[model samples]
Target chain A: MIRIENVSFKHRATPILSDISLDIPKGGVVALIGPNGAGKSTLLSLVARLQPLQAGVISVDGLPVDTTPSRDLAKVLAILRQDTTIASRLRVRELVGFGRFPHGRGRLTQEDDAIVDAAVAQFDLTDLSDRFIETLSGGQRQRALVAMAFAQDTDYLLLDEPLNNLDMYYARALMRSLRSVADANGKTVVIVLHDINQASAHADRIVAMKSGRIIADGTPGEILTPDMLDTVFGFRMRVETIEGKPFALHQL
Target chain B: MISAVSKPSLWTGLIAGLGLAVLFVLSLAVGVSPLPLNKVLSDPEAMQLLAVSRLPRTFAAVLCGAGLAIAGLIMQTLSRNRFVEPATAGTAQSAELGILLVTLLFPAAALWVKTLVAGGAALVGTSVFLATAHRLPPQQPFLVPLFGIVYGGVIGAVATFAAWQADLLQFLSVWTNGEFSGVLRGRYELLWIAALMVAVAWIVADRLTIMALGREASIGLGIDYARMMQIGLVIVSVITALAVVIVGMIPFVGLAVPNIVSRLMGDNVRGTLGWVAAGGAGLVLACDIAGRLLRYPYEIPVGTVMGVVGGAVFLWLLFRRGGHG
Candidate 1:
């Protein structure tokens, strides 16, 4: 379980996340949905210890995030930010192999190589594994980045806006892959998603936020109503039931 | 999925090694007083010239070239910009300033003492540049080299002004323009330390490669990002200081060699570090030989030749497709 208690953050005296506390259990997909500047990414960054904690205590499976060594934390949780740029001329497979650095400290063992191969295959990147990262399309590069994160083999994966720059086909494919990874591997996934329908279709739980505070938290069926959408997004959006799952039609 | 381990071809290594060997022989053979191979072996005075002047000068050229190129590679990786080098990043200028201060304060100081002081000043200057570079947005890659050039110009101007005021402009000129003419037995030993530092770089090549992935990803990979950056800065400073102190500032060796090596061999440091080092050494040796032959007994500085050659290559790099921002 990942427990966040009394978490608050500010950027140059302007509050970003205020008095936020939440509990995320292990082995389920949890999607964080919010409007622009709703502090969704900030919250995820804090949880991943990408940003230092100002007023909070966070623990992953009883290991305090603030005090835990980064190497130790890396073994339990992995994070993928939206704008992570790599400057090195790395091929897709080589990039994914870097995820095993914590385990091998730069020397990849046979087992580590197997894990990297599996990650590449799992992400449908086998054909593009030999290509340089700069040569790949945005969606393909995003997949490579995600594959790198997946090769970390951590218990909890935190992804912020992973769908950015992805086309519709890739977006759905990525969501389905995440869903399968969470279900089959028993890994806890906390994702910040901009598309409500993607979250509603694939996520086991939905948490809505507005202006740095959680407004609603429940299953998709309980939280995807038109009234909740307006409260969270500050606009009315119709919610429709599609094949027993709640889908938000916010495009109109 | 393909395996991640990519090694440089044996042929590339063989060719670089052979080229370096040929240049090394040429460096020893050509000079103001050309000593024939049989005469040097038989005549004590000829042997002395070869040992005291030619050998030391050759070693200095090779070591300085390799060290500066490796240092440039580290700086480029850490800064995430292709153009930032020891000369442009203010490190060499700062070391020159340190040399000037020591020369004025302790005119009788040993060569090692002066070199150490220069290294210290170079470290400070490089650290300041790294801190500033980190705070700036990395979206525009050109901004980094521009900042470096402006920053180095400021430092160089200050040094020049100080030298002029102290009536030491002539003394400063020797340290500003790189030449192997002054390299003798005891004068060029400081660059051996730079060679050792290059070995250190090879040992930590993987860490340096990971650092190029940017801060967050590096941290996520369980690397101590700040510590690695500090290590890189120290290596660059030491290498730059030694080069400046021993042979003056050789432009473009560090910047151009690594860029060319990476373009040809890829960016895997483990695979490319040796090639970069060899390429740097060969380029400098070639330039040093050219400088000697250009005027026969009265030679131009290697720094001038490199500036011309390296400047041309740098411009070509800028115009290359997908080369810059």
Candidate 2:
């Protein structure tokens, strides 16, 4: 389990996250849903140690996130933030190869190369593997980035709005891929998602936030009600059960 | 598998052999006296010019070019921007200021002492740029080098103003313009230090590449980001300062050469590192030869010729590459 205790963060003078505390269990997809400026991405960044901890403590599988060496932490958790753009003309496979750097130190062994190839195949990017990243479409590039993280072979995967810029088909495909990976491999996949229906469909649990505070936390069945949606998003959304899962219809 | 991405073997061999041949011919045949091949073989005075004078000048050009290009590559990688280089990072300007201080304080300081002082000041200047960049938002990746230019410009203005008041503007101008003429028996030996810095860069090229991927990426990969950055900055400063001390300021050779090579090849730091060195040496050698042939007796400074040509070519390359910023 990943446990965050009394975490608070401020950007200069403006408070971004306030006294947030939560425990995320392993082996499932947990979607963090919130309105704009609700600190969803900031919280993910903190858990990944992309940003330094301002107050309180976080532990991943009993190892303190701050005190642990970065390489060890990298083996345990991998994060892909939104809008990741690097000014390099690198092929998709070469970019994926970097995920093995913590282990191989840029001199890839047979096992590291196999892992990279697996990630490429798993992401259905075999054709695009040799292509430059800048030449790929938005959805393809997003998949390539996720594949890079997958090649990291971490237990915990944090994605901030992985669905951004993806079309409806690609978006659902990505969510389904995350769902199966979490179910089959027993990995902890935490994602910040803007699509409420996607969260309702793929997420095992939903954590809703408002004004930097966790307002609701429970299974999707318990948290996807119109009342909770109104509380978290300041709107009344239609909720219906289909195929033994709650689906929130917020479009319109 | 022999992929299309790989450079052709023949092309590589041809470029390497031709580059070496041109550099050797330039070192032997062209200079103040233009010693014929026979005279260089038989005459002692001509032989001294070939060994001590023309030869060192040639070596200095190659070493300076290679060192500065590697330094530029490191700076560009660390900043994660295409346009950044030691030349653009206030490093050369700060080194000039250090040299000025050394000359003013001790009118007869040793050449090595002057180089040390210049390199120290450059290290401080590069550190200041990096530290100040850390405080700003990460969105403006290009701003780091842009700010460096502005910062270097301010310091350069101050140096010019001071030199004007001291009535030593002529001497200071000659020092700052980056000449290969004074590179004779006793003075040009300082540039060998730059070759050592390039060797050090090759040894740590992997860490530098990791650091270039950004602090989070490097840290995530279990690399010490700050430590790697410190090493890169030091390497850049030393190379820039040493090159300046030996041959004044060579303008954008650092920025232009590595950029051109990386465009043809990929961003594999190890692969690009050697090509950058070779490309740098070739470019500087060609410019120095052109400078000698153009004015004959009057003789243009290689640094000034490189400034004009590199500036035009660099702008063309920038526009061709769709303008980085």
Candidate 3:
């Protein structure tokens, strides 16, 4: 479980995240949805300790994020941030192999190599494993980056805008893979998503944020209402149910 | 579907090794007072020149070449910008400043003392550049190198002004124009220290490779990014300072060599470092040899020759990359 209390973050003098508290229980998929500048990525960064906690406390599975050694924290949690640019020309396999660095400190044993292989296979990257990352299309690169995070083998995974450049088919494939992995391995996934219908179809719970604070948190069916969408996004959207799942039609 | 890029082949290593060997022989054989191969063993004067002058010059050239290349590789990786090197990033100019200051204040200081002071100044200079770079927004990739060039220019101006004020302008010119003409046995020993540092860099090549993955990814992989960066900065400063002190400023050997090696072998430091080192050493040796033969006895400085050749290569690299960065 991840816990946050009275968390607030400010960049320079402007507040990015206001005082907020939330608890994420273990072993399920939670989709974080929000409008632009709503602090969704900031919140994820704080939980992952990508950013320092300025005015609050965050703990991952009872270990305080600020005090815990990064190596120990890495074994328990992994995060894939948005807009990561790699300067080196790394092949897909080599990039995925870096996920085991926290465990092996660069020297990979047979077991570590097997884990990397599994991650490549899991992401359907076997064919593209030897291609340089610079040559990959946007969606292929996204898959490779996510595969790297998956190879970390952590209990808690936080993905910030992982679907940025992904097409619909790849996005659905990624969400389905995330769901299966969470279900089969008992891993906890916290994902920041933009498409509300995708979150409605795949996520076990939906977390809605507006103006640096969580406005609503519940199952997708509970939080996908037109009123909740209007409050969170500052606009009205139609909500409809199809085959027991609530989908938000915000395009119109 | 696995489209593996071509790895560095054994043939490449063999060829580079053979080339270095031939260049070493040429360096030894092509000086003003050339010693015949047979006479080198029999004549005391020939043997003395080989031991005291020729051998030291050859070794210094190789070590300086390899050291600066590795230093540049580390700088590029740490800065996450290919164009950032000792010459552009103000490290070499800061070292020149240290040499000038020590030359004035402690006129009797030994060579090692000057090298150490220069290295310390380089560390400070590089640290300032890094601090400023981190504060700037990362919008344009070329901005970092442009800032480095401007920063280096400021430091170079200060060094030049100080040299002029102290009446050491001649000394400054000699030190800034890199050459192998003065590498006597005792004078070139500091380059061995640079060789040692390059070995140390090789041992930590994996850490450096991880660093090239960018800050967030490095930290996410549980690397203490700041600590690794500090180590890289220290290595880069020390190598650049020592190279500048011993051979003057060998421009673009650092920049051109590593960039060329990465183009051929990819950027995994562990796999590519040896090639980069070899390429650097080979390039410097080739330039030094050309300098010796260009004017026969008078000789152009290796720095001048490298500037011409390396500048052309750098321009080609810029255009090859479509000038985006």
Candidate 4:
């Protein structure tokens, strides 16, 4: 379980995240949905300890995020951000291998190798394991990045907008893979998504934010109501239910 | 057929092997006074020069090159910028300032005293940059190095003013020129400290690599990003300061060598670091040899040649980059 309490963050005088509080229970996919400048990324960053908390407390599985040893935390949680601009020209296998760094440092054990290989296979990157990351397409690179995170074998995975730059086919494939990974592997996945339909179709819970605060949080059926959508998004949107899932028609 | 199918480790070993052989030959054969191969073996004068002057100097060059490259790697990792290096991070300038102050304050201070002062100053300078980076808004990582360069320029102006007042302006110029000609027996031993720094770099190379993938990724993995950065930057400053004191400022050996090696070997610091070191040593040796050969008796400083080569390559990279690869 991840708990955030009374978290308020500011850059200079401008408050980015104000008086935010939430508890994310263990397991399943939790989709964080918000438009641009909605503090979605900032919240994800705080949970990952990317930026220090200004006036709040966050804990992951009872361990304080700031106080815990990083090596211990690395074993439990891993994050993948949007701007993955690594300077090294590492191959897929090599990049994925780094997920085991907190465990083995540099010298890989047999278990480490097995884990990396399994992640490569899981991401359907087995054929491209030897290929350098720079040579891969956007979708392929996204898969490789996810594979790297998976190879860490963490229980909780926080991905910030993993769908960026991905084509429609790859994007759907990635969401499906995440859904399966959560179900089959029992890993808790928190993903920030721009596409609300994808979140509505796939997520177990949808967390909506606007202007750096959580406006709505519930199951897709509950949160996708027109009134809730209007409050969170500041506009009315038609909601359609198909096969027990609510889809918001906000584009038109 | 067996030889044609080369293993990855073998390829790495082969590159390292070739680098060592070339470095050895270059160290022995090229210098101000040429000794015949036969005479080099038997003559005491030739052997003494080879042992004391040439061999140590070559070793110093290799050590300094490798040390500076590793330092640059750590800086680039800590800063998370491709263009940033140890020299660009105000470390080299801080060391230069330390040297100037030591010389001006106490004219008869020991070499080690000056080196210690320089190393400490470099560490402080690097720490200041890290502290500022923590406080500042997250921008392009390269901007940290640019800001560092600006900070270094300001500090450099102070050093220049002091040097001019002390009538040691010529001495100050030598820091940027980076000559190894005076690196004989007693003076060059200080570079052994840089070799020790290489060992330190190896121990923490994994941490530095983890830190390079942005502070958030590292912190998410349960690593104290700031502490790791501080450690890496300190190591970078110490090695750079030691290198500066021993042979002045060898520009861009840090940036160019590591960048080239990572291109071929990939960017895993643990995997490519050996190649980075070997390639750095080979490049410095090759440049020094060219410097020796270009002018025959009156050699151009290796630092000047490195500056020219590094500047050209950097410009080429800037102009030719079509996309982030």
Query: Chain A TM-score for each candidate, in the given order?
Result: 0.97, 0.97, 0.98, 0.95
Write candidate 3's Cα lDDT for A11-88 as tens digits: 999898999899999999999999999999999988887788999999999999998988889999999999887668
Go through the candidates in order and give each one's C-alpha lDDT: 0.89, 0.83, 0.89, 0.81
- Residue A40, candidate 1: Cα error in Å is 1.2
Q: What is the per-residue lDDT of model 2 for residues B1-325, given as tens digits with 9 covering 90 to 100?
A: 2122655377886878687677768766886676888766778988887878788888888888788788888877877777767767788888888888788888699888988998999999888877776676677655776787898888788778877877778867766787787888778877887888888888877677667667776776678787888888888888888887778888888889878876676676766788898788878888888888898867788888988988887787668766533
- Candidate 4 CAPRI assessment class: acceptable
2 against 3, candidate with superior lDDT: 3
Q: Write down the TM-score for model 2.
A: 0.92
Compare the candidates by TM-score and give the number of the best one: 3
The better-scoring model by TM-score among 1 and 3 is 3
Model 4 lDDT tens row, B166-228:
899899988757777878888878788877877877887766676766666676556766677
TM agreement with the true structure for every prediction = 0.96, 0.92, 0.96, 0.90
Per-prediction tally of clashes: 0, 2, 0, 2
**Pairs of colliding residues, candidate 4:** A70-B222, A70-B223
Candidate 4, A139-251: lDDT as tens digits: 88888888889888888899999998888887888899889889998888999998888998889999999998998899988889999888877899999999989988898
- The weakest ten consecutive residues by lDDT in model 2 chain B span B1-10
Tens-place lDDT digits, model 2, residues A102-160? 77677889999999999999878898887767778888888888888889888899999
Report the number of backbone clashes for model 1: 0
